[model samples]
Target chain A: MSRPRVIARLDIKGPNLIKGVHLEGVRVVGDPNEYALQYYEEGADELLYIDAVASLYGRNNLTEVVHHTTKNIFIPLTVGGGIRSVKDVELLLKSGADKVAINTAAVQNESIISEVSRAFGNQCTVIQIDAKKKNDKTWEVYVDGGREKTGIDVLEWAQTACELGAGEILLTSIDQEGTRRGMDIELIDAVAKMVNIPVIASGGVGKIKHIKEAFINASADAVAVADLLHFKRAKLSEIHPYLISEGIQTRKVLGK
Target chain B: MTLNAKTISILDYGIGNLLSVQRALDAVGASWTMVKTPEEVKLSDKLILPGVGAFMHCANTLEAAGLNEAIIEHANSGKALLGICVGMQLLFDYGLEQGRCDGLGLISGYIDKIPDQQDDGSARKIPHIGWSELFLDEECPLFHNFSHIPAAYFVHSYMVIPEHSNHVIARCNYEGADITCGVQKENIFGLQFHPEKSAQAGLEILSNFDSRI
Candidate 1:
């Protein structure tokens, strides 16, 4: 059976890796490549580097970071933020990103999803949805680092993006993000059921059990953790083993 | 034991993630280079064909770049050649993606989309993206260091069904079926997964390939 991917999401600001609460009050952590290599060595299934300030800056600045880090880290590297065009996607891929996630640009021009997927394969294009609950069952989509409300229904946008040839969805919950409260199970379940492609549940993971819950309860294909890993509160080595003990298939843990 | 002097040429036929494969080779301490021209492909001791995208487009690009003939000649000369993902699919008789597209015909097989639903009547994800354990159906030099079944990362919607079962070197269980993951016939090898992104076990596999050449 295929195992749920454990991805370490490193939010970048300039050259340093940063962490924030609900995507605010950002604080610098350490070198991005340092954390990335450590995670790769500790058995992370994949690494996601999101430039938290890229959208605001109007250009991607993580290309050099990705190119440098990928030389040492062999696992799949996913880079997102400020990916506004097919040329941007081409630049990041040339810089060694296995996949490029588009959040703001995808919402603005849904055609970019199909454009990137057509130029590259669907596997290369990822649709990232920053969602916040608007009601009991409805979630509103936000863009521009979760600052602007697109007024688009989360499920509707996800389904449309998939129809536009998105191979995967990276669903982030604004309410649960950086809270350590755990993933939005309802949101994940809703989107996973709505789309045929794999959905990666991100935000609000406090412990290893939360990761397992994202997989078992929400049927998420992968879980992306940021605060827990960036803060050194949990290690992937222990997390993978704990998940394995719970009968969750995972990539074999390596190193000490 | 070092491959310092020997540079394994990774064919850049205008598609696929070649950097990850290059990093994997670097991790194994093997020298490598990216080759696009026919002369570069002919000069390398070993070649790696890595690709991603539509099969018809990839096949057509390879043919237009004259990489098809160069790759076939390289394989026929008994030099080691490896294909990953769509590159592996391009080694077969033909691909049914987009339309019926002819492959390099390095091996007898056809590429087709994986079944959408399993026998259990449950919906199976279109692109089988994630890590899965590989069961060695037949021993091959590519997996020499692995003491047991190792999981590798896979991201694809289509699968290669070789003409001869003996060519299948490894299989992985997906949904309710055992899908072919690796194929080996003579010096030519094909892997449907991204071993470069598969962590340490994948590094071992790349090291094995490097050592064999």
Candidate 2:
């Protein structure tokens, strides 16, 4: 098993960092770069910045944020939101992002995954699935930041994306997002089991226990925390030690 | 072409993430420039080859751009030459990614797909995307201060098997298998890990390379 990573995820709308419930009704949190740099200093394993409304606006605006963060932050950075094609992936990767997350474009075309994988190595392509549970055993893929549905089963889509050369899956539970209740353990577990690629469980992680649940219960390679870090409900300093104390292996964040 | 005064030259054939390498070199306080043409390659004393995308495609792009000759020549001249990721893979004689393809052959090795199954016959994650602990096995001065035996950031679906064990400077364990993470033959070195992105440990590696070489 790979070492579990605790990622500080920042969702952006326009120029401001924001958070919302069930992928809607977002409120401004703070500057994306400021929060990102803080997490970097606090020993976050990695940093993820998603342009909150890029899908609706037909553009991504985190290029500068990525540039600014990588200036001093010395960790892997994954940038998502509205990244649709290999060219879009190229832009972010050039701007200092180590990986690019695609959802709307890949779901709409399907072939974009293979194209990006071939162009920039599968390691550079990430499939971001905004999933909402359709039933006890099924989750549907949503696009444009949960504003639209594709009727695609989340498990099937994840497997297909993996076959099409996606390096990792950013599986977010629309239902549990920003709820501070917990992660959609069932959804993440199902997708993680269906594919051999790493699955990063995103959305709805409140307490330190939920983070452990994502690793032990869901087998998530990484857990993305937005609400907890954004609202100061938790800190990565607390999260990393808790995991190790529970017998889970994580890289020692060499921070003060 | 004049071998200008830039301390390091990152060979840019338009395939990999050159900006991050640029940033890392900057953070380590190295004077560097992007070399795109064979003539520019001739002007570089210390060369860093960074690669991404399919192995065959990257090999073809570098060959098509005619930068390989000057790079090989630079290596032959006893100057410091470093390859990162696919750039490191290209130093091998052959790469079996899409098909049998030729490489710079600075070192004797082959680049091939990482086995779908782990050594224990369990399912292994392709691309190996994460930070893995690296074990230093050699005492080459290039790693003199790149020390601390830090964990590194890695992202690739291919493996490089150097023909000689003496060339391997470091190794890392993955799924009960010992994979070569670093190779060095004199001034020519290849690193499977992305030192440019490995946090402080990475910066330390880059800093060591700059100061030591």
Q: Cα deviation in Å at residue A54, candidate 2?
A: 1.2
> What lDDT tens digits, residue by residue, belong to model 2 across residues A1-256?
3478889998988788999999899999988888987897777878888888899988888788888778777788999998877788888888889888998999889999999888888887889999998889899999999989998999999999999999999999999998999999999999988999989999899888999999998889999999998889888878888899998887766656
Q: Which regions in candidate 1 have their CA more than 4 angstroms from the true location?
A: B1-5, B147-149
Q: All candidates' TM-scores? A: 0.97, 0.96
- Model 2 Cα interface RMS deviation (Å): 1.7
TM value for model 1: 0.97
Q: Report lDDT (Cα) of residue B83, candidate 2.
A: 93
**What's the TM-score of chain B for every model shown?**
0.95, 0.95
Kindly report which residue pairs in candidate 1 clash with one another. none
Give the top-scoring candidate (lDDT).
1
Off by over 4 Å in 2: B1-6, B146-149
Supply candidate 2's per-residue lDDT for B76.
Answer: 95
What tens-digit string does per-residue lDDT give for candidate 1 at A127-212? Answer: 99999999997999998898899989999999999999999999999999989988899999999999989999999998878999
Worst 10 residues of 2 chain A by lDDT: A247-256
lDDT of 2 by residue, B1-213 (tens): 566554788888887878888888898898888889988888788899998877899999999998888989999999999999999999999999989999999999898777779766788877687778888854776667554537888888888999999999988876665788899998998899898878777888788788887
